[model samples]
Target: MTKPVAIKRRIGRPPKEDSVETSNRIIDTAAQLFAAQGYAATSMEQVASACNAGKDTIYRRFPSKADLFGAVVDRLRAGVLENLENEINTIADSGDALERLRHLAKWFLSVNLRPEMVAFKRIAMSEAVVFGSAGQGQTDKDPIMDRLVGVVEDAQRDGLLCGDNSTVIANHLIHSIVFGPSNHAMLGGKQYDDPAIRDQYFDQAWKLFLHGAGQ
Candidate 1:
């Protein structure tokens, strides 16, 4: 009798060989659990089990459950908003600010109001209630909010907008665009469901913003 044919197997990503690789794997797994279960309800033991990592591995990287939760938040924040932050800064500084604003309005309602983003924003706020004193470097800040405000300030200088408090004006514009539509979408509904409707809404909102801010 011949020996059994050799079994060929393709292994997955090579076993974690370094600290950074290990930390990333843990954070990715932790983010999914936290998003689905919320912070207080999740634990390090669960994270270790979910990631197929040992408790010792997790503890060595994050000494506490809160630390792990904080890592999850940071990772989620970067994944969700980093690109938008960079894009807004570049577009705002590059050309006709009002035209940029119009383009941004269309793009914003189209992408940022999607189900995934709305879900993240809603759950993140609820979870933050219990994020008390974690000492986690602020996960993210009203992502793109400051950049939008700066754009408005630039628009004012160019006389496209007339406003004394650029921050307040920015807040009004951004909030009006995001909150109501995103709120509807979060509950299982906006632009995300239908692009035509979203564009229609954006056109009206954009016109109104320009009319009011130009005054």
Candidate 2:
């Protein structure tokens, strides 16, 4: 009679795989839609539809549209940040200050000029202009900019560059190297579409940067 004993199955939090999979799908779909439609026009419902997910799914993961958009922006920048850190490590053995910065600058432009990044930047900048910040998990400090400043400071210590403020020096170099190409690409300018032309532009910019900031 003591033959059968019933065991209760554990009911707890679900496996992380499902949550992660859904999160990635939502983010990827939102990125494409926001990039294609502009942030103002893209809606959560559209994102959910693209993800083949319910609206509740998005709301559960991200509290609001701003939150979801911020997630998209964060993920894009995070990926580039990781790659840029790798680029920094890859060039750590280089002895020339300007040359080291040159490698970093090239990597920066190549990654940021990707169509998806350009779209995200355009939207994020628009958000910042109106809201004073790209709210919800965004910080005013640019980690890449901080790392750029570090490189410039190291160059200054080596007397490879001259500047009263290495921060300003680094800022000038980055803006010169990135702003024109980034702005043009964001506006759909076709001039830098070819890698050859892009490299030519970068080389010319690097030379000019050296002339102005190198010692």
* Model 1 residue 166 lDDT score: 88
* TM-score, every prediction: 0.75, 0.86
Give the Å shift of residue 125 in candidate 1. Answer: 3.4
Per-residue C-alpha lDDT of model 1 across residues 29-56, encoded as one tens digit per residue: 8878776776767789899999899999
Error of 1 at 207 (Å): 2.1
lDDT of each: 0.73, 0.83
Which numbered prediction scores highest in lDDT against the true structure? 2
Stretches of candidate 2 above 4 Å error?
1-13, 126-137, 213-215
lDDT of 2 at 94: 77
Clashing pairs in 1: none
Candidate 2 per-residue C-alpha lDDT over 22-93 given as tens digits, one digit per residue, 9 for 90 to 100: 999999999899899988898999999988999998899998777888788778878877887888898898
Cα deviation of 192 in candidate 2 (Å)? 0.7
What's the true lDDT of residue 174 in model 1? 71
Least well predicted 10-residue stretch by lDDT in candidate 2: 129-138
